[model samples]
Target: MALFLLAFFRRYLLLVLSFLCQVYVLLIRGTPIVVQVMFIYFALPLLANIRIDGLTAAIFTLMINSGAYISEIVRGALQSVPKGLKEAGEAMGLPFYKILRHIIGPVAFRRMIPAMGNQCIISLKDSSLFIVIGVAELTRQGQEIIANNFRSVEIWGAVAVIYLILTGLIALTLKLIEHRMRIV
Candidate 1:
């Protein structure tokens, strides 16, 4: 939704909104996601005096962090849509939102598939990072088992394999969807 608004009104709202959007993207992409998570989970409560649980913090952190990058991908895709299509839509007396919903969105989303797939893979793997904040994710669970059983190599190996399987499944699923959605 943020990306949609930004891309749709970017020209009309270019001056203030564009700068704000750029700033948001810069801040999100500049810092490591781990740091972002840490800040939200720890520093936010300290500064705001509002207590949020680790899970909530982690979800918010990941959502905002991923949202920034995804917005950029979507923004680029929206821009890459051909001007002729927009012109044609206008010629047919279609409204802007109709053109966007029926034409630009579908085409640009198709273009965004590969990049979106990668981001999904990254997010899945990154969930492990929440272990640092004691969020009890897959990596954290693996670590606990290793600590109890003293099977570091086996546990870590299994964890790695699980992650690999997850990413593979994500890639496979995306490929299937891409094939189905392909223009050919």
Candidate 2:
């Protein structure tokens, strides 16, 4: 089915995008995320005569930002996959794409799940930085609540708890996948 094919190639496409994101990371990692958000939200409007909404800008910035780190994780996992597996796939007369799909990708992906999970958690936390650009994510929402109710301690604490819950869920999901993919 078309859906299965799409799912199958998603990783490869993500891998390529992740590589590009890695390059972005190498360039911007030293800069603060606040600066990055400001550049997209403030500088772009002034320089390019463009205006993008907070949520869209935040998602774009975070995707590329997180992509950079995720890409490095992906590259390492790809490299860690055993070379013998590729040879075995080829020996079975599998084509390059087939070999990658059936062997290289699955093996590398399973090994990379933990790192990927780490990246996801990092990304979710980084979403808080979007508050600088006025996006209404959890952090921004908390800020608004505090601004209205003057309950900085309680609201911010609740926001932190929400992020912890989200990250914990991500960790559990990755653990399940890692268990399912264990080599035995």
Candidate 3:
């Protein structure tokens, strides 16, 4: 969410602030978050003397990875706002920031709902990848339970249902938001 706000700030308020953001997005999107997590958790200690635990590394790596994608979604949505409204806002003696806050932000955010909501679901699914780093996430727990009880059918079924519920909630919530934001 903060990254989404920063994306808007960079696009309209301060161009220079966006350079580093763009590089961060490029680097994160260029590589798999798994590899990024591995680098942070393992390579960083050997090369830069920065060592974080698996969970911390995984969380931060996922955050940066997701932030990069979310920023793009936000930027695209913000850019889709019409140029005329900005000019009008300027004619009304409004600063760019105020125009964005009162005008562009709401419209862009409404447009952002569908894409951003999909990203939320993607983030949830992607978190399962952290199991490779020994995060003991839902999938890992399912694996452990199956190994112990040989109930793969039931355990996996339950896990699948839980994930479905989560993604469903995200979709439903976003739909509600979109409905509420309708220009009444």
Candidate lDDT (C-alpha), each: 0.87, 0.76, 0.88
Q: State the weakest 10-residue window (summed lDDT) of model 3.
A: 6-15
Alpha-carbon shift of residue 19 in model 1 (angstroms)? 1.7
Worst ten in a row by lDDT for model 1: 3-12
lDDT of 1 by residue, 31-79 (tens): 9999999999899999999998989988998888888878888888888
Ranking the candidates on TM-score from highest down gives: 1, 3, 2
Task: Write the residue-wise lDDT of candidate 2 on 74-158 in tens digits.
Answer: 6677678888998999999999899987888888788778878887888888888787777888987887888899989999899
Model 3 residue 86 CA deviation in Å: 0.5
Candidate 3 residues lying further than 4 Å off, grouped into runs, are: 13-16
lDDT of 2 at 151: 89
Residue-by-residue lDDT tens digits, candidate 3, 69-100: 99998999899999998998999999888998
Which pairs clash (backbone N, Cα, C closer than 3 Å) in model 2?
21-68, 22-68
Top-lDDT candidate index: 3
Clash number for candidate 1: 0
Which scores better on lDDT, 1 or 3? 3
Model 1 stretches with alpha carbons more than 4 Å out: 6-14
Q: Using lDDT, rank the candidates from best to worst.
A: 3, 1, 2
State model 3's lDDT. Answer: 0.88
